[model samples]
Target: MEPRDTATRYDQIARWWQSQHQNSSYGIAQLKRAIQFTAQRYLALDVGCGSSGRFINVLLQHGFEAEGLDISREMIQLAKEQHPGTTFYTEDICCWIPPKSYSLISAWDSTFHLPLNQQEPVTKKLCNALEPGGVLIFTCGGGSINGEISGSFQGQDFDYSTLGVDAFLQILTEQHCTCRHLEYDQYPENHVYIIAQKCDRSTSTTPN
Candidate 1:
């Protein structure tokens, strides 16, 4: 499904999601692990931040000025209510532009929802939007090929896609990022997460 369609679908269950994840530890541990690699805490972003405000809270607690972006109006609305002063956007990441460089960016379980064809460019955009030495943490369906799949959650049918491990690593290299870590966090499930840090091309080297 398109990001817009997924946004509408999430709107149908935004409140449900908020209630379910209010205290969930699902991605909290993983996010913390990713945060440890970043040396700067000036600015961070939570793309596809749902209504729970979980990731945003963590970022703020760590001294970063955090902003959120999600395509769902309902999700963004509830997020605003939970964190009044924090900035949140109601735009698709595929088309939304980053206003400034970030010290860290977390996509978590969000970017997997993008259309397959948009993955490469969007990934590159995110990497380019990072400051030198900035880190990016994101999840994807683990594999060695590119593909799409549909699944149901919260009574809503949603779609997910992946560029697979190799391709994603390739993009990171091309964007002057070094893959810091990669893992199949959920071994039985095809869930994979990657931690990448952008390097100063002038003083850094991309692996051959």
Candidate 2:
């Protein structure tokens, strides 16, 4: 399915999403781990950021000027209302150009919804959008081979795709970013998260 179709699907359940996750602690620890790798907290972007504003709140609390983007208009509307002072973009990730580089970009449970072929290019795009010392934190279905699967959330069906672990590592290397951490956080479910940092030539190549 196209990204806009996913947006439409999410639009149909925006409030249900917020109501379910508004007070949840779901990605907090992982997000904070990614935050520590960023050398500068100047700017952060939450991609595929839904209506809950959970990640946005974390970014702001960590002292970054945060922005959020989602393809769903309803999701962006609620996010804008909840985070009135922050910038929100309602656009497709594949078609939208980042206006500026970010120090920390969190895709969280997003990105995997892209059509299979768009996976590598979008990962490259996000890697390119990072500053020299920036960090990218994102989630993907884990395995050694590329694949796509269907899943349901809040009664709405959705698709997820991944380029697999090796491809992701190769892409990060090709983009000049180093994979700082990769974990199958939900062991049996294949839910994996990765933290990668853009190499900083002026400093040591490892996260402090």
Candidate 3:
């Protein structure tokens, strides 16, 4: 799908997302782990942050300056209402230029929406936004590229071109980031969680 179409898709689903996932056990557990794994109290950007703002709230509670950007205006508005103390913007993740470096950057389930062709550049930008030893946590379905799935909220799709644990590690390594931790397991619903840390230059070397 084209970029604008993708944004519109999420915009259509924003309200349903807030209502359905607000009390999701899986969602809460993931946010909790993300907060606990953050190594420093610095700026963080929640890319594709949906209406719930659960992860952003967790970051704020842990003393991090958190900001969120989502393609859906409806989602951003809801997030603002729920989290007035934090900043929320209605912008596409692929086009949004983060204002400053972050110690932690999370994409959550949002990355799966990007077309396979756009994933690499977006991943590179996400890595560049991180501080020397920053962390990036995200999740995706475990599978190969497939056709779109239309549902009540919107048309959902999967592009494994940028999915899976090994592909995630390769992207980080090529970006001069280190893989400090990785966990691969299919939850009951077959989602995979992949977490990695940007390497500290004092310890990692870049190619000349």
lDDT of each: 0.93, 0.93, 0.73
Which run of 10 residues does model 3 get worst, by summed lDDT?
Answer: 145-154
Better of 1 and 3 by lDDT: 1
lDDT of 2 by residue, 48-145 (tens): 99999999999999999999999999999998889999999999999989999999999988899999999999999999999989999999989898
- RMSD in angstroms, all models? 2.1, 2.5, 3.4
Specify the poorest-scoring 10-residue window by lDDT in model 2. 199-208
Candidate 3 lDDT over 42-102, as tens digits, reads 9988888889877787778788899998887888888898889887778877788877899
Reference-based TM-score, model 1: 0.96
Quote the positional error of residue 63 for candidate 3 in Å: 1.2
Cα TM-score per model: 0.96, 0.96, 0.83
- Better-scoring candidate (TM-score), 1 or 3: 1
What lDDT score is found at residue 11 in candidate 3?
71
Q: Which residue pairs collide, candidate 3?
A: none
Candidate 2 TM-score, C-alpha based? 0.96
